[model samples]
Target: MTTSTAACAFERKDWLDDYAALKTALEQRYANLAWFASPQGGVDLPALDKRTRRLLETAEDESMAKAALSAFVSGFHDGHFSTAGAVLQPKIAQPLALPKVDYSRLNATQACAALGYGPARGAAFSLPFESLPGTVLEADGLTRAFRSGVVAAPDGTRFGVVRIARFRQQDASPAACEQAWSERQAKGAMSEADVKPVKQAANAAWLRTLAAQLQHFREQKVAAVVVDVGNNPGGNDTGDWAVRLFTAHDVHSARMMMSAAPLAALYFDEQLDGLRQAQKEQDPTPEAQAMLEQSIAAFEARKAGIAARGCDLSWAWSEQRPWQPNGCSRLIDAGYASGQSSYLPPKAFGNLKIASSIYWAAEVDDLRGAWNGPVYVLTDGGTGSSAEMFSALMQDAAGARIVGRTSAGDGCGFMADAPPVVLPHSRLRYRVPNCVRLRADGNDEVAGVKPDLPVLPTEGENDRERAWRLLDTVAADLRARGAKP
Candidate 1:
């Protein structure tokens, strides 16, 4: 009556082992674990173990194990915490058949009328659109699911409309970049030459796209521009170009902090090495050398302080606390005063304050004479990550009006590159964020960016139609106010 282990449908022992490994990895590596643990009812290690045991006991296969893991991760309610490597076969609902629109023979004005808009006295152009459920049309040698262009009111006021589907770079595709990364890894460690080209091309293309839009606005003498980012899942930080076009100086975007000293040290070392290599290739200017020297000195001081504390190399300063000389006093006082918990590091490690650094958008030289007109950005719950970051910058730095629903709160904090790990047993890949972004104002966290003019769709009105209506309304309002370009 004895059963062989290999013949069993599910192995409880194997599942338990994998679960233990995953728990350890999460505790040690997950950036948000400490912050979220207490809020989620104090971790409850033994209770978690018991729950996981029951889950494994009932899990019929690897798929069930993965489901259990996914459920466990979802309890954190963190958008960044996710499980990959699951072959999902979701049920597909039948799509509704809709009539397509034809605009091949129509001129710009006629096309605008056909697309449910009034006469277009100004130029109309095609916009690259995707994901939106609508009829697409070919215009000006471009495939456009939506039309975006300049419109001039009868009163001689002009407005520019630009619809952006995502924050992805213009020239580089995600699939191509991923493939290139894989190829580079197989060849060996990536060099500057291997990585720089794709990044440079993407940057150039993104800047070019923004520049083109700005040039068009200037040419049309538009008093304002509407940027549509509705239903954007977000992508790269290429939205910086738009920020630069409106901002005259450097703008402090966000603050970044690492959970571990090793991570920060690794980043600093990489930056230093890159700068030094550049210096070696050609003599750096006096100012550049001085900057490098200062950075080196700062890095050394931090390293010495860490060594003196006797703390593990992995220990990093908490971003929650200010980096004063006696910053650790409050932590120590709270722990000793309560006697319920201790914030102190191991005896081998001493107390040290870690400093949080600010990220800024540097002024762009090419954007010196760029558009300074009023800006309106459209957002929705689907706007997240870099899209949220862009919206924050547009609102905080460029004085752009956000006109739509509140954005997705994915960029509440910052995340650094913590690559995914594959489980040995079920081969499930877990992606963990490395660093937590802390802002002094705490505005970008959780609540997301608020819209200046929150627009909601009415009955029988779709999101697209509502957005267009809002854009026109805002333009008219600006026109009424005698806003000038």
Candidate 2:
């Protein structure tokens, strides 16, 4: 959104108390309170408090207090609710000028010149679309499934192009289902000795189909393979699996996050106390009390382990000290324990398998040597997380050219830290942002990855138009390079 303070509207007395209350809440959430109690631990609460106050007083839209407050809260950058519930989202401004282009040829040099800027003076000119090195014909029809103007090659035995517009849970392929079932059955029925042949056969069959497809494109003397990994919002790991047909590589990076101890403590202590007090009256039987005592012991043990880990959590969290809530001070075990709470938070693999598998495929096979064809990838704005990861890895491993706008910026990778919370008054459920999307360089900003050859289609191009532009450009480029289908 526009971070320009000049554009906002503000009034002096419109929301004085609300602003003050919001400021207090924010301070409590982020200020380092734990160090205040320690002899050597000094916190800069006063400075932080003063800074926050100043921001509020000077905020541009004091009349629209909620917006200013929310923006201020987001400034903390902790991925939590720093502002009040009244805040509204900000709007971002689009760029003033579009990139230069020609409908005829897809050459980067020509495209760059069309944009009015001089050629990237010092920038290296790698043929990003060259990732599709073996195809003779362009596969442009795959955009039907992705209505967001994705450009993909027509699925064929000779020259195949696949472009996923976004990651969607509803897009699981039947082939994926079959593969999962086969893996499960093989694991259950076959001994270690018998499993190898079965697994090999399955893998071989998959690779064979891919090999045949690549071979067809090779015969056509294709010159490139383009992958459009634009705004893919991420679907099943199968998306990565599909990418394997064109490239060889595996995703090796992994990321996971845990809640802060203080936060966890607050949740458990309050929740446990409530449970213990309720159990005392609801089920006064000796068995119930005994169970409660046992649960408390488990919680204590877990807390001790947590302390030992010495995580670099926030300072405010550290001061709470075995901070068990009222009734929960004695029995705070999680759901895995024999108490009321027994479930763990959900875990996501971030398409680890899919990533690694594709990397492996691309690394082992030399697309330039194997397929005499062009590859084109089509994507839009929904691609994120694992989808982004897939794109980054493919570009690194096979030089697969990207042919779409930047993807959604949520790919750094994240997982749900807590269950969805429905507000008592509004009945609206809110989820926490706990994942990060980063490139190999560790930059976790969003927008999306830029395309090598930027193509902004006319509105009339439609989804079909977008797809045709990518394929048509690639084919014309190939013919210029002396390749013929």
Candidate 3:
């Protein structure tokens, strides 16, 4: 466990080196520089740097040095910002010597907290599924009936409800995959070769099971369907697949980019490589072509910014643009066409990572309109990450109505495969989300997607009543919409 770099005593020279290394890494890897530096975040990194640097300089021992470093990162007040681990060498990073620190708990930084970082607003989406009549499929287990069926509206109309609690492929996988996974986990370590196909098979099963549920809804001749993501804490790209299943047309997800760092360049290159492979297999549809163009421009911008400002994003330190009155910089949009694209580049939410072995590039092409009918989604503050993503996509892409309240404002957090960035002296490893998802409104999803048909608790309304009222409202609207040709 003790290499030369790791074993370095907290001598003044060693301490300073660690501080400098950590500073350099943050400059390069921390993605929030643009947003936090802008008027939006108002984080005066230059001033904070001066203050923290002085603290580090005065430190005669390790404890003082740690405090100085923690203060510098803490100054941003972002939960995403924190120390990672100790570095043994140039590229080698390991876990924390102390417990891994989650900066989110600090809550000092207005960067996220002020912008709805904590509990989201509005009523919970706990609908009365138990109250439905016997004619409808009684939801049994998570699998048996796929946790779906029909709900009878008070006025004698019928509607379908599909409750998707989470988006993890492993969770929703087939029974066979679950058995294989159970067996695999029993072993000390999981081998990649054996794990991936099991997941893919399960994902295919999950999708089929869901598709079948939707088909059942269609067979029942329901006026519309409500996709309930209440209390749904987001997960992987299953959101992308789920959105595709509900609507016949292509639905564009949010756009995102990382800060200009080594990983940023790598991220863009890997994406381009994926695109190249895509081109090899099939012709570039207009959406793929557009995604390519926008992506290339973003890639070049990060390169140019890095070339101009170095890793610290120094260009924004002293009012680079009139727009940056707060003394921070923001990544300029790469001129995407019409804010809508037919295809989403694979891993658009998550690009390259050091931790993974395989990457899937197949875009969800099921435009067969799985539900073709009017679709409405139910969400609450509990809905976050990919769940919030589903809410946005269903509303923006499929023309589905989002009812209840605003979603959890997670927007985008850590991307796939969080390989740590260890400091040379301290060896403290850390990571940050290298990407962001921009909603169609030109705002980041960090500002939670607003519901189209907003419903909140009237002062005395109980949780149960609130849920029923929302359903009643949806039913009334569907009845009105149904009356049309």
Q: What is the C-alpha lDDT of each candidate?
A: 0.50, 0.39, 0.59
- Quote the positional error of residue 30 for candidate 2 in Å: 12
Stretches of candidate 2 exceeding 4 Å from the true structure: 1-159, 165-170, 174-221, 228-231, 238-245, 249-374, 420-429, 445-447, 458-465, 472-485
Q: Which one wins on lDDT?
A: 3
Instruction: Flag regions of model 3 displaced more than 4 Å.
Output: 1-28, 36-128, 132-138, 174-194, 272-363, 416-431, 458-460, 479-485
TM-score of 3: 0.63
Highest-scoring model, TM-score: 3
* Clashes in predicted model 2: 84
| RMSD values, in order shown | 14.5, 18.8, 11.6
Say which prediction, candidate 1 or candidate 2, comes out ahead on TM-score: 1
Which tens-of-lDDT digit does each residue in 121-177 have in candidate 3? 221225656454532654543444245667766676666877776776544433535
Error of 1 at 130 (Å): 13
TM-score, cand. 2 vs. native = 0.42
